[model samples]
Target: MDAIVALHQRVSQSRLTAPAPDSIQLDLLMRSAARAADHGNLQPWRFLIIEGEGLIRLGQLFARVAAAKKPDITQAELDRFTAMPLRAPMIIVAIAKCQPHPKVPEIEQVIAAGAATQNILTASFALGLGAIWRSGEMAYDDTVRQAMGLSNNESLKEQILGFIYIGTPDADARPARQINPKDFFSTWTGE
Candidate 1:
């Protein structure tokens, strides 16, 4: 598929099924992510690929975090939390590994990571696979970060930019919403 077409038509697929992207498709996604614009040449992003048993571990971590917050949490609630990661066949946890840079602020570093995530989603569509970027409260929890081998220290940014769920689409992806660029953008001129 042409890059422009994919960029314009990409839509998040919420109901994904098994059969995750193969190695070749993943390579394309990774390569696309690597090209995200970075200020000061500081590539301040990293990804943790979770699949198979790794998804189980991630789900357990989510449930544990939930239980830790509410000691009386019910099994149903715990089960729900556990099933979150199972929504996708694979997950790519995008992490913003910010570093001190004279010219680049921490927010810029985070944006770089976000751009990489956008590339991942677009590339997934181009490959005829389904993907979605998601991050809820659990994503930013200190315990969750710790479980991922990250510290809660100030330096870590403490942001799980996204958990990119990837899998085969169970149905046709929703059509892109029509939005006129003219309404969103315009040239600036001093009047």
Candidate 2:
């Protein structure tokens, strides 16, 4: 697919299935992510690729976190949390590893990581694969961060931007929602 078309038409695929991207495709996705806009070249991001048994382990972690939060969590709720990671064959955990940079603030580094994630999503669409970026309470939980080997420190910011789920689309790609550029874009002038 043309790059422009991919950028314009990419849409999140919620219903995904196996098999996940092959090694070559995964490499392409990573390369694309590395090309995201980075101010001062502060490459403040890392990704964790999870698949196969790893997905099960991630699901377990999710369930564990949920149970810890609510001791009264029922079996059905635990099962729901456990099955979250099984929605896709593969998951790429995007982490923003923000470090102190004289030129780039922490927020810029985080945005760079987010751009990397967007690149991954666009590349997945271009490669004829399905993907969705997800984040919720689990993302901000310190336990989940520690489980992912990320720092839980309040000063040295390290955060999970999202969990990018990748696989074959269970259904056809939905049409991209149309929006008028005029609504969001306008000329800025000194008034």
**Top candidate (lDDT):** 2
What are the per-model C-alpha RMSD values against the true structure? 1.4, 1.2
lDDT of 1 by residue, 103-179 (tens): 89999999999999999999999999999999999878888887887644655554688799999999998899999
TM-score of each: 0.95, 0.97
User: Residue 10 error for model 2, in Å?
Assistant: 0.6
Per-residue alpha-carbon lDDT of model 2 for 128-152, expressed as tens digits? 9999999999888889999999974
Give lDDT for model 2.
Answer: 0.94
The local lDDT score (0 to 100) that residue 140 gets in candidate 1 is: 83
- Which TM-score value belongs to model 1? 0.95
Q: Could you say which candidate leads in TM-score? A: 2
* Clash totals in order: 0, 0
Lowest summed lDDT over 10 consecutive residues: which window, candidate 1? 150-159
User: For candidate 2, what is the TM-score?
Assistant: 0.97
